[model samples]
Target: MKIVKVEEFDLRREVEYGSAEQNEAVRTIVSDVKKEGDAALLRYTEKFDGVCLEPAGLRVTQEELQAAYSQVEPSFVEAISAAAANIRAFHLRQKRNSWMDLQPDGSLLGQIIRPLKRVGVYVPGGKAAYPSSVLMNVIPAQVAGVPEIVMVTPPATGGKAGIDPYILVAAAEAGVHEIYRVGGAQAVAALAYGTDTIEPVDKICGPGNIYVALAKREVYGVVDIDSIAGPSEIAVLADDSADPAYVAADLLSQAEHDEMASAILVTPSEAFAKACQAEVERQLAELPRRDIARASIRDYGAVILVDSVEAGIGVINKLAPEHFELIVEEPMAYLGLIENAGAIFLGPYSSEPVGDYFAGPNHIIPTNGTARFSSPVDVDDFIKKSSLIYYSKEALLQNGATIVELARREGLEGHARAIEIRLLKEGKAGTNNDNQ
Candidate 1:
């Protein structure tokens, strides 16, 4: 990792989501799925995942879900269950109900909150199992009362013929019954456009590689997506009093995610920065994913020397990291100063992994610089809101003139006349334009 003074260091680090060729590849996959449906879905699944299946074999069967229990150990089951419980409990608080407000004029105005009828959650598989993602994506939608939840994953996980047993168990634990063995841009396309085998979903949620991200971007309007997530990143804001070991270890946690992942450290004290940099070197040597972490730390990691922790906060806001760890004294005092970041971790004890797994908050967060505008996945992602307005005869008669005048001013004759007819019938058409 390169160490530089914050004042002199360039803040610009380009986030590589994918190249144009990658986006075009994803677009073509999406287009094929849209046009060919199940036939195209099967071809792409076989082409990319090396697994060929019939239409009927696309969906995971009840027998497979049952068999998954026998394959995994009891301890693994216990741990996944505990994690699922925490996730479910947290999202249940975000549940919303349809509400209305009554007025004196016998008019009812309110917002109706409705859970999306069907939702699709994409879990990354095929040599990588993300039971955590399965829990994070499905629990919120379930809390929102979504009737049906469809899950799609790569055809083969760890080069096996079937899905990972742990992933299946996790999805089953989260109350997601419909699991499909398909992945990549084609699965996203299928979820958006629908096929005879897989029905279209109202929204798609979860993280994947650049292909998955670009696929979600391609089918965004056809189906809503959580966000076009970039690679994982973490920024540590520390002071002289912070522990160098803890800060360095946390930075390495994110750095090991991928070669594109970023792990940055910003501190006021030059000595502390040097100490943490050394600790990172020591820890990185032992990490099993050292090559990946080394590349990430080498290419993207940095130690920035800021004048003060407050000044460091300014740089953090500009970066808008997926995870921000404040390892200084009185961390909460500076919480309000942080304007961007998907999730904020205060104090040395509150590690980033805590929130990623056991914590109730969803781990699916905004990535790259998107934390400035986007938010973590939550119950709101699985529901829709419609404004309700009930106009009684008296209310319409009382407000008709004002409505007609505004409509006429906008040159919408049809709208003005619609209000005009009501006012004339109510014998209130003669009222003054502004006051009415």
Candidate 2:
């Protein structure tokens, strides 16, 4: 690892940026699915997932789920159950209540909160089985009182038409209504534009490869989607007191995610920065995914030696990292100064994986500097709000002339006429100049 002084501007772009080829491929997949429906989905699944699945048999059945449960160890199932309980408990606090307010002039204003009719959660399957993602995605929708929560993942090889046992168990614990074995851009298309077997969803949420992100972008108008996620990233803000080993391990945790993932360290101590760098090299050599982590660190990772803690904080806010860990003397001291970040981990014990798996926070976070304007998935993602308004006759009479006058000024005669006709029918306004 190399340590460099912080600069005001770094012109080089990160390699993790999405490509035009991916966007075009996603567009093609979405179009094909829209035209051929289930047939297109089956064909793409075979091509990408290396599994042949008929549309009718795509959905996972209760019997299959039971078999999956039987395949997994009881201890792993217990852990999944525990994690689900914690995730559910945390998101339940985010639940919103509908409210109405009455005005003195016989007017009522309020907002009604309702869960979306249905939602689709995409979980990646294959070499990586994310049972934790299943919990994070489904638990929030369940907490928001969503009636139907459907999940989709790519089918495994050898005629396996369902998710791994851990994923299935987690989905069950999170109250998912349905699960399907479909993957990639085609899965996104199926969720966005319902096929014969898969029901259309009002919204889709999850993380996936570049194709998945692009597919979500193309289908955005047809169905609401979570953010277009990029590769995972983490930024550690530390001082002299921070432990180098802990810092290095935390950085590698995200770096190992992919060759494009970024791991940055912003520290005030030059000695600590060097120690972290050395420790990162030592630890990377021992990781099973060392090749991926080494490439990620060499390409996108950074260790900036800032002049002061304030400067470190400024750099963090500028980066708007997906996962931010504060390993300073007082991690909470600079909490108020952080204006942007998908999630913040305080103190040495709060590792990034804590929130990724067992912690209540949603791990489906915004990446690639999107945290400046976006937020992690939460209960609100599964719910919609409608503003309610009611005006009594007295209230209408009180404001009708002013409304008409405003409409007339805007040259919208129909708008003025609509109010004028109503007021005239009630005998409240005989002439526009009566009050004047």
Candidate 3:
């Protein structure tokens, strides 16, 4: 890790739109799935995942969901159940009801909120299988009252059939019964446009590799996606009071995710910055994914020097990090200064992994600088809102002339006539038809 002045450090990477070859491949796969349906879906599954399967074996049976419980230990089930309860309880608070306001003229205006009819959650298999993510994606949609929730993962992970046992158990625990044995671009296409074995969903959620991200981008307009996630990142805003070892460990937690992941520290104390830099080097060697973490630290990790902790907050706002940690002596005092962060962890005990696993908040957050605009996934992601208006005769008669005047000023005669015709039918039109 390098130490530099705050002005000298620049860690932002260009947005990944994928290469032409990858984009072309995703386009071809999506087109094939749209045209050939299940046959194309199965072919790609075999080619990409090296798993061959018949059409009859596409969907995971209820027996498999039940059997998955036996493959995992009792402790695993108990832990996940507890985590699920916490996640459910947290998201339930975000649930909203439809509301209406009656006007004095007998008109009604309201917003109707409803969950998407169906949702598809894509859980990665192989080396990146995370049961924690299964709960993060599924529980929020369930809280939003989505009727049909389906899950799609690769057929085999580490050369084992029926996917990973932990993933199956997580899905079953999350109350998702519709599991499919397909993955990659083909699976994303199948979720967007229904195949013989699978049904189309209104939205898709969860994380995957670059190929899956490109696939999600391809099918975005046809079906909504959670977000095209980038590599994991962490930014620690700490002071001399913070322990260097804990800071270094927390930074490496995100760095191990991939070589592109970034780990950064911002502080006023140059001595504290140097201490953390040394601690990061010491800890990097012990990580099982040290090779990946080492590259991440060497390429993207840094300790930025600031005039004061207040100055550090300004730099962090510009960076708009995905995960932010405030390890200062008085963390709460600086909370209001933070304006851009996907998830804010205050104090030493609130580590990033806590939210990733047992914590109630959704771990699927905006990455890169996207935290400036977007947010972490919550109950709102799975629901849609429609504006409702019931205009009574009195209300329309009173406002119709003003509406026509505004419409006609914009050179939209059709809009003006729309209000005028109604006013005339209701016997409330003024003597001047144009004004009405």
Candidate 4:
């Protein structure tokens, strides 16, 4: 990590996620899956994952899920059970009820909150097995009362041609049984368009590599996606009071995610900045993924010197990072200053990983600068809302002329006529033929 003045440092990266060739390749895959259905799905699975499968073999069987339990540690199952409980409790709080309000004129207005009929959650298995992600994604959908939740993952785990047992156990514990052995753009395509074996879903949630991110971007309108995720990143706003070792450890946590992952720090004290910078170098040598973390820190990480905490807040908002840590005096007092972070960790004890694994909150958050407008995956992502409006005869009569006037002003005669027909039948438009 490098230390520099805030004004002089460039925090943003100009890298493109998927190139034109990759996009065209993904487009071809999506199109082929849509056109040829199961055949294209099978071909791409064999091509990218190096695992060949027939249509019947795509879905994981009940026997396989049961056997998966025997292969993993007992402690893992206990941990998953505990995490799932926390996740379920948190998301259940977000569940909404269908509400209706009766008006004075005997009209009813309400919102019908209905869970999506079916949803697909893509859990990554290529780079690493994220059984924790299985809890984060599927638990919320289950809490939302979604009838059927389908899970898709890479066919291979660590270059081997079998599903990761941990992922299977997590999904089974999360109350999702319809698991599929496929990943990458092909999985996104299969979920979006539906092959002969897999049924289509209303929305897709979870994170993946650049290709998976691009695939989710490509298949957005065909199916609702959580977000078009960019590289993972973190921004820490610290002061002289912050522990340099703690700051360095937290920054490196996100850096090890990938080479493009960013881990930045902003502080008023130049001495603290230098101290953390040294700690980062010392700690980077200890990481198993040090090669990847070193590139991320060298290319993307920085420690910025600001005049005060107030100025640091400005820099933090401008970046709108995925994970933000406030390792300063009175961290809660500066909470209002932060307006654009996916997840806010206050003080040194509230480390980023606390939320990532054991914490109840969804770890699947908006990456890059998207926290400015988006949010973490919640119960709302698995549900659709339809506004309900009903008008009594008296209410319609009172508002009919105003609606017609606005409709006529827009030159939408068809719209005006539709309202006029109801008004005319109700004897409310007796003296007006303005539309005619």
lDDT of 2 by residue, 196-217 (tens): 8888999999988888888898
> Tens-digit lDDT track for model 4 on 162-242?
799999999999888999999988899899999889999999888888788888898999899998777789999999999
Q: Residues 244-310, candidate 1: write the lDDT tens digits.
A: 9999999999998999899999999999989998999999989999999999999989999888889
Judged by lDDT against the true structure, how good is candidate 2? Answer: 0.87
Assess candidate 4 and give its lDDT: 0.89
Q: What is the lDDT of residue 26 in candidate 2?
A: 84
lDDT of 3 by residue, 1-436 (tens): 9999987877566766788999999999999999999999988887877777888888999999889888999999999999999999999999999999999999999999999999999999877789999999999999999999999998784334577889999999998899998888899999999998898999999899888899999999999999999989899999999999999999999999999898999989999999999999899888899999999999888899999889998988888999999999989999999999999999999989998888899999999789999999999999999999999988999999999888888878888889989988988773354533
Instruction: Please rank every candidate by TM-score, starting with the best.
Output: 3, 4, 1, 2
Give stretches of model 2 more than 4 Å off.
8-17, 158-162, 430-436
Per-prediction TM-score to the true structure, in the order listed = 0.96, 0.95, 0.97, 0.97
Q: Which regions of candidate 1 fall more than 4 Å away from where they truly are? A: 157-160, 430-436
Error of 2 at 406 (Å): 2.4
* Ten-residue stretch with the least lDDT total in model 1: 427-436
- Backbone clashes in model 4, listed as residue pairs: none
Where does the lowest 10-residue lDDT sum fall in candidate 4?
Answer: 427-436
lDDT of all predictions: 0.90, 0.87, 0.91, 0.89
Pairs of colliding residues, candidate 2: none
